[model samples]
Target: MSSRQGPVVHKFGGSVLADAAAFRRVSTIVHSEQQSGAFQHGALLVISACAGVTDRLLAIAQAAAAGKAEQAEQELQALEQQHLGLVTELGLDRGELQEYVRRLCAELAELCRGIAYLGELTLRTRDAVLGYGELLASAIVAELLRRELPVPVHLVDARRVLLTDYHFGNATPMIGESGYLLQKEGVTGALQRGEVVVTQGFIGATPSGIPTTLGRGGSDYSAAAFARALEARELQLWKDVPGICTADPRRFPEAQPVAEISYAELQELARFGSKVVHPHAISPAVSGEIPVRIRSVFAPQQPGTLVWHRRYDAPAQPLALAWRERCMAFRWYPKGNSPLAEMPEIVDTVRKVLELYVVAASQGSVLLVTGPSTGTLEELYGKVSFLPHQFVLACIVGNEPSRWTWEALELLRNSDAVSAVWTGVSPVALYVLLEESAAQSALAELHGWILHTHALQRLRL
Candidate 1:
């Protein structure tokens, strides 16, 4: 049932193809799709590690950098043996793959020795070392797939196509130029020839051709890039979760799958640490006007979530709800009439400290909401020794505003979460704050309020 629909990009996370068994599952999926004519246009599959591989690789890198060559060597050999064992389990002639493993192991050993001798592992070197996990996984998965399926598979060096800046561990991609190169170099033509292209995620080369690792969870972004390059009809991301949900299903129990979400909303959730998909993954599809689908690798039959440019046609109020934990609120009070003027400085100070934590932030005049802990914030600003004139902060967040945005503020004003709200600055934003213990109840109450007031419907009318 393979569709005659040209080419689509399918990116599988590390867990999806982690072990020999997972590889068998992947082969089943690919072959079934081809036989059923569902993948008429064929597919470009981007693979990550067998589960738990990257963490071990990272530990070895850390040990090597910390001058523990013996430990690093032992761990590196374990990884090599693990992959070699899986290759054999897949029933592939291990002779060729064994050679590949030897090469990969040799590279790791040489790099670790250098790290141990230098007694340091710089960010650049660490990124270079950690980039191999995805590389090896992609190669092995592609080879296994080719053996079981009729499709010709090409294992691409993502570095050859994905160009980036020199920022070692967290490089930013030159997306526009790279997309142009991919299109010009006939990525479409290659796919049209019925070849399954395989490439590593999370690693790209610099303009000078040096390997650079993308930011954390950058593999999703890499998949998005490939989708845009091929002008794909669909870009599918397979993950552990069944799809985007109204809340963390494990926590909410009653949380439901979101049938669809606008790219804007998905980005908002991602920025708030929704864990559904990388926030950056939505951008390529959004910009290219391509539909990106999030489906569960575990429950592939379910029609997950489709993220598109404009809002969905249906008038469904909100498709999902999300919660972020360990959220910190920074409360500030300025002395007397000057409080308004000092608000800017407080905002600036919060921003500077937050940059170090790599946490996302949203701000109101008197409070800043972030996902970092209070202790972490204190350590970041310890040198400044700047005491807040008066303030207290816990965690505060909710869904779209209810009729009680002002009422919520009033509740905070009269309660003990923080000091009196600053009146000098305009309350342009109505971001709420709550303690971790009360967040769920607060959200439920707010939802009830919105329903009774029909606030969203009223606003529309």
Candidate 2:
């Protein structure tokens, strides 16, 4: 009666396995599938650390960098205790896991000492510190599976598998060879034998043997990469929520889940802060044309959002309603009076510096928004010899776009809060610039406009 046909790759987020009960639930979930013959080809689970672990690890890094040795030690102790508590709760005998936890704690203490003594936390060092969460999670889950499940489970350090350059943070995969190594190195055989293998996400070792991490939420991308590597039939992301809703359930009470959506649309939603899938994760899977499922741990039976490559030509309605937050729009002008000549360098500098997805760019202007870090933007603006006085960045996303700027100004809008009237640059989105205080009012006003405007109500789904 089981519907699952072949090998499946499942990723569990931090919230899904925060403790023993959650881990047990996961075990049961995996157990049921294998028993019912749902996991016919086998399964691979990528696990994240318990909720709040990464934040704590980050705090430890920050504190150590700031010379707060005492503070860092306190936080490190708390993390150790948390892991120890989980082990005790699971009622497992103190064995390999205990040793691993002890080793991790010692390494963390050394990391703190290094930070305090060196007085600088480089990107490489910080990444090494941050990789602990995924490692701990992977280890614990592997141990748990061994204790509870009937299948043979193997633990593989992704560092050895997902090899990459020494980028430290935001490392890109050395795909061609990494995929080959993983396939040849028993990944294919393990799945063939119906053994469940566990691997860490986000953290991978560089070619130079230093720890490197795939920026935040890199786990999802890692899972997608793995699926593509193995050519798995389905990639399931077990999240805390049911599926991608029409709107954020917190923001819109009447929000409904989207049963299925195209990868392109999902990418747009992710860029606009949908939280449905990592915007970066879509590219690889879409190119491969593999179906990615976003399911909820709470409702194991419900069909969640499915991400695939499909042309959405449905009736004029929004597939999902999403908006970006902490969004700031930069309005900049070239220092030179000549419009077209200086455009390339100006745009290139910003691109090199920020590495941002340009929502709008022109010969004399630019607009940029980042949901993550602002380092790139800061670097570009700081190093580029732009005529500083020519630029004025505004929070244009989600604001009422000015109607009069259509002809002369190159308006670039990326946020959903802007009404259709303000978005003159494109037919899809309206971009605006405003302060944080006015964002709510801007959203409300735009909501009214969007509900009534022919532009906003039209959905391409």
Candidate maximizing lDDT:
2
TM-score, per-candidate, Cα-based: 0.77, 0.72
Model 2 TM-score (2 dp): 0.72
Q: Which residue segments of model 1 deviate by more than 4 Å? A: 1-6, 36-38, 180-186, 312-316, 325-342, 352-373, 376-432, 435-438, 444-461
Q: What are the lDDT figures for the candidates, one per model? A: 0.66, 0.68
C-alpha lDDT of residue 339 in model 1? 59
Which of the numbered candidates is closest to the native, going by highest TM-score? 1
User: What value does the lDDT take at residue 101 in candidate 1?
Assistant: 67
lDDT of 2 at 428: 30
lDDT for each residue of candidate 2 in 361-444, tens digit (9 for 90 to 100): 655565544343456456555433332221112222211234323421322254433322334443333344435554555544
Q: What is the C-alpha RMSD of each candidate to the true structure, in Å?
A: 6.1, 7.4
lDDT of 1 at 65: 78
